[model samples]
Target: MGKTLAEKVWDEHVVRSTEGEPDLLFIDLHLIHEGTSPQAFDGLRLAGRKVRRPDLTLATEDHNVPTLDWDKPIADPVSKTQVDTLRKNAAEFGVRLHPLGDIEQGIVHVVGPQLGLTQPGMTIVCGDSHTSTHGAFGSIAFGIGTSEVEHVLATQTLPQAKPKTMAVTVNGSLPEGVTAKDLVLTLIAHTGTGGGQGYIVEYRGQAIRELSMEGRMTVCNMSIEWGAKAGMIAPDETTFAYIEGKPEAPKGADWDAAVEHWRTLVTDDDATFDKEIVLDASTMTPFVTWGTNPGQGVALGANVPSPEDFSDPSDKLACENALDYMGLEAGQPMRSVKVDTVFVGSCTNGRIEDLRLAAEIIKGHKVAEGTRLLVVPGSVRVRLQAMEEGLDQVFIEAGAEWRGAGCSMCLGMNPDTLQPQERSASTSNRNFEGRQGKGGRTHLVSVPVAAATAVRGTLSSPADLVPAGV
Candidate 1:
């Protein structure tokens, strides 16, 4: 039988395979950050082993790094220690380190692709769940536990059972106001949170092909949120164009050779996936999570659904709890929901392209008086690029806060967090309870939706921002 993309990538990286034993696959790139590497480094210290391939390993300060005045000492000792420990370990172990002040410093997932370290036909692992973001380049990328991190540090190989392959084909074209984020949210809602379990999902068909590299990354970035082992997108001309001139990308003949290999990485024509799902993109609308979980979402035109609307006992219970926590009522129009914070940044949507879209959509529009709009770039490089384009000024003039690069407001790790009972229309992945902070409610949204929500101070579709009859 012809092979799927996941199988092809897995088979190419096998170092050892035994009957009754998990295959040992060599990892091409191992990305690490402050929060998750300390213990892994400690494991290395106790074993007195150096990083087997420091050249292939990259580390940076994120999670706890402040988006504002990052150069200043971190106020939280635990956060400071994690950053300090990572720096000490990276320097001691001779690994390439990008600290807060470094131009290359930023979220690991964002930095990898931006710097060209993430590429097609590679096996990548990070100590972060969103590492699947790198899979946008057609690589087999996934997250590892701390011990797994240590194992990769020492051996650069991981033992893994093969996951089944699944295909999510979105036919036709997405509606004007819909985004890659909306498409992925619709997928999760179709399959629920555990829908992709034990599978490596390949996003294909017309709508996916129409997406730019940035849009592809946004879809793959949230794969983990749907319980997928990882996500994969077949490398194509668009992928090559995005990586061709990056700092770590190959030059001249090397580049040509790399592209040749990547071209062969797609799933075979006769390949059959273990599971399949098909959707009509034209029917998908911008999604907003009325409940805490991402799967508990509905269309922009949808109303808040009652728990009793669900058939499954677990889903019904979850819906009830989510509604109570989010302070929402059934039968209420989603557009009527108000928000105090509108965050535009995360590994999912903090890229340069995302920033540009949000800035363009929100230009000349004042943020609502009671709303706080925070626009943060994914990396220092993205931050500098935005400033050069004066996107920062556009946001500032519109009453939004132009912040530095980091995973701000995506979770409670950094200083940019929502307070008790505070609700936000966020571009970040995950809307779990306290994902932003204790007693905080989150509604996952696309960049354009978050941009419009900031101006309206309510959950809104991007279409609502347009002047009528335009």
Candidate 2:
């Protein structure tokens, strides 16, 4: 029998495998951030161990770094301590770190790919849940806890139990207004929050193959939202072109060799997945989360679902609790759900492509009277490129705040948070209670939906503001 893509990658990286014991897998890249690395680094020190492969390890300050006034000292004492701790830890461990204000400094996931450090057929692990984002390069990337982080640091290998393979096949082309965000949201809704538990999903089919690398990243970034161990798409020409000439990408003969090897990373024609799911992309629409979790979403025109709509008792109860927390009612139209703030950046959708999509809608347009829009780039490089293209001016003219790069408003860690009882249309991944701020209700949306919501001050899409033609 042929091996699946995940199995191929896993088998290559397996240093030791026992029939009844966990496999010892070698990790090629270990990315770290301030939020989760401090404890792991401390544990290493307490145990008198040094990072076994500092050359393969990288550290950055993102979650705790303030997007505003980055030149100045961080005001939040706790945030400052975490950033400072990572710097100290990186320096002591001989690990390369991209500190705040560095051109390379940004969200770990964004930085890795933008720098060409993440590539096809590699085993990438990070101490962040969204590490699955790297799987867009056809790598077997996943998140690890602090204990596992320490273990990887000491041995550069992780003892792991292999996950089952799941094939999520998307056929047909996506509608013009629909996006990968909507497709992934719809997939989660179909599968439920815990649907992919114990499985690593490989997205395939014509629709998946046609997406731009950025779009693929957006989908993989949210795999964890559906409880998948990881998400991957086989590398192709699009992947090669994106990595070509990138700073860390292989060059000359190395580039040729890398491409030749990457070409073989796809699942064999006879390979079989443990489970299979097929979705028709033509049937998808712009999606938005009506309740707290990502699974509680509907098409842009859908109404908030009533608890009675669910056949599962637990699902009914979850819907009821989500409604109460979200201050929403069943039968309410999701399209007109009021929003106070609009955020357009996160690891999930904070790339230059995402920015351009939002800019296209905001150009020659103005934000709604009461809505505050924040247009944050995912990285300093992305922010600079946007400025060069004058995308920043487009947002500014539209009455939006064009901010610097970082994970702003994606989570409640930074100062860019929603006030109590406020609601926001965001392009981030999660919508769990208080994910953005205390008492702040979040509606997960695509970049187009977020941009239109900012213009209309409600849940919306570009089709709502711009007619079919000029």
Candidate 3:
């Protein structure tokens, strides 16, 4: 049988197999962040063990750092301690760390790929749930809990059972204004957030092949939302081009040899997946979440679904609860919803490309008078690049609060948060109840939609804010 990309990468990284047990796979990269690594490091200390391969691990402070001030001390005691603990742990374990104010500091997922540490065919593990973001490079990456984090730190290997494989083939060309965020949200809606259970999904077909590396990352980053163990795309020219000049990428002859190996990473013509799904990208549009879960989404032009529309009893109950939590009226046009805040930053959509897209729409406009708008970069590197292109100026001139890099507003770990009873149009992933703050309601949208919402103080699309031409 022809092997899928996930199988090929898994086979190459397997160190040993035990009778009647899962293989002990070797991990090439271990990523750590402030939210989950403190306890893992404590476990290692109590056991009197040191990191087996510090060279293979990297650490950064995100999730708990204030985005508004890079130099001031963290105001939240719990958040401050988390960041302090990570720094102490990294120093004691001889692992390199990008502190809060460092130029390389940002979301762990964003920093890994930008630094060239996430390579094709490598096994990557992180303490963050969104670690699957690295799969864009054809790597087998997944999230690990704190216990698993300590296991990898002590042994440099993980005992994991192989997962079933599924193929999600998106064919045809994506329409204008449709983005990776829309594509992923649509997939979750189709798959019901539990369709990929017990499987690693491989994204294929012409539409996926045409996506840039960053876009691919955006797709794979949300695999977990669909119950997939991981999601990956085969490495190709787009992947190679993105990694060419990265700090950790191969050089000279090594680069040439690596490309040759990556060329053979694709699934064979006859390869079989445990399951397959096909989607037409041209039919997709800007998607937004109307309910608490990512799967509860509709196209921008559609109305919020009434509970009666759900045929299944369970689904009907879920819809009722979601509507109550979100304070949304059934059958109402989603575009007419008002928002108190607008956030555009997270591991999922805080890249330079995402910032550029949002900036393009907000260039000559100002944010709504009563709305709070925050524009955060994904990493220090992204922040610097955006400044070089004057994107920072454009955002600042639009009356948006230009902030430092971190996982701000993606979750409530940091100081950036929505007040109680506040509704927000956010570009970040996940819209679960209380995700932003207690009693805060979130609606997920694309970068352009987020920008437009900032301008109008409502859930609006870019088409409504900007004309077709400039």
lDDT per model vs. reference:
0.92, 0.93, 0.92
Model 1 C-alpha lDDT per residue in residues 218-273, reported as the tens digit of each score? 99999998899999899988999999899999999999899889999999999999
- lDDT order of candidates, best first? 2, 1, 3
TM-score of 1: 0.99
The segments of candidate 1 whose C-alpha lies over 4 angstroms from its true place after superposition are 466-470
Tens-digit per-residue lDDT, 1-470, candidate 2 = 89899999999999999999999999999999999988999999999999999999988778878878999999999999999999999999999999998999999999999999999999999998999999999999999998999999999999999999999999999999899999999999999989999999999988899899999999999999999999999999999999999999999999999999999899998999999999999989999999999999999998999999999999999999999999998999998699999999999999999999999988888899999999888899899999999999999999999887888899979899998789999999999999899989999999999999999998998888964235
TM-score of each: 0.99, 0.99, 0.98
**lDDT per residue as tens, model 3, 271-345:** 899999999998999999999888999998999999999999999999999999898899899988999999998
Highest lDDT scorer: 2
lDDT for model 3 comes to 0.92
Error of 2 at 232 (Å): 0.4
lDDT of 2 at 151: 96
| Residue pairs in candidate 2 whose N, alpha carbon or C atoms collide under 3 angstroms | none
Q: Candidate 3: deviation at residue 332, Å?
A: 0.4
